[model samples]
Target: MDRYVRSTRRAGGFTLIEVMVVVVIIGILASIALPAYQDYVRDSKRAEAKAALSLVAQRMERCFTESNTYVGCYGGATVNSDSGNWVVSITESAASYQLEADTSAQHSDGECDPMTLTNTGATSPAACW
Candidate 1:
């Protein structure tokens, strides 16, 4: 008796090539998403820094109004204030007065400066204040 042999290959769930293609697609999607997510994080951090800085600016203004003196650059000098993670500093040179907020959480030894709180202005990543 002769036996019949099946020669056609069956369709499986996924092949190696298909799996690899899916992985590559996912990788490409992640690569596109990561930078946008990072930018969002930076923007949120910057917003926090700005809000903290605004509060500090108001406080500095009040201090100035009450004592009638230009407050100098004070770094993280707030004691028992609402702004727990901020270093509020005011610097007045000859004409303009600048209020800066430095972040306690993202405080870098070299890059973390109150005046540079927004990390190279509105174009770069932001530090948490």
Candidate 2:
């Protein structure tokens, strides 16, 4: 009688099905993570814009206190956020002023694209502020 022995060697690498499963998992994770990250970045940019608007509003108030007008305030400083994420535009009269912060690029911020603040400490789109 002859005895048979079983082969001990096995394939060392992953099979096609295993590799495909891993790829699918990675893709799913990325799909979820990418959107969350983008949203976080947009929200941070909006926060920066809000801060810039507040600082400008303060400067306007100071100008009114000293010169009794909001015109030509900020000492001719550039009307943009330090990060360049926002472009500020001012509309002012002798007593009151409005500062609007619009996105500097095409990054659409559907929630609050143009944030507004006034010299009287009022902010628009109350949910955002």
Best by lDDT: 2
lDDT of each: 0.54, 0.83
The lDDT, on a scale of 0 to 1, for candidate 1 is 0.54
Q: Evaluated with TM-score, which candidate comes out highest?
A: 2
For model 1, residues 18-128, the per-residue Cα lDDT tens digits are: 999999999999999999997776566556666666665565556556766444534335422243555555554332346565567553223434533221133122443
Pairs with backbone N, CA or C atoms under 3 Å apart (clashes), candidate 2: none
- CA RMSD per model (angstroms): 6.8, 2.7
Error of 2 at 2 (Å): 13
Model 2, position 116, has a per-residue lDDT of 93
Clashes of each: 0, 0
Q: Stretches of candidate 1 above 4 Å error?
A: 1-11, 70-76, 79-86, 90-98, 104-113, 116-129
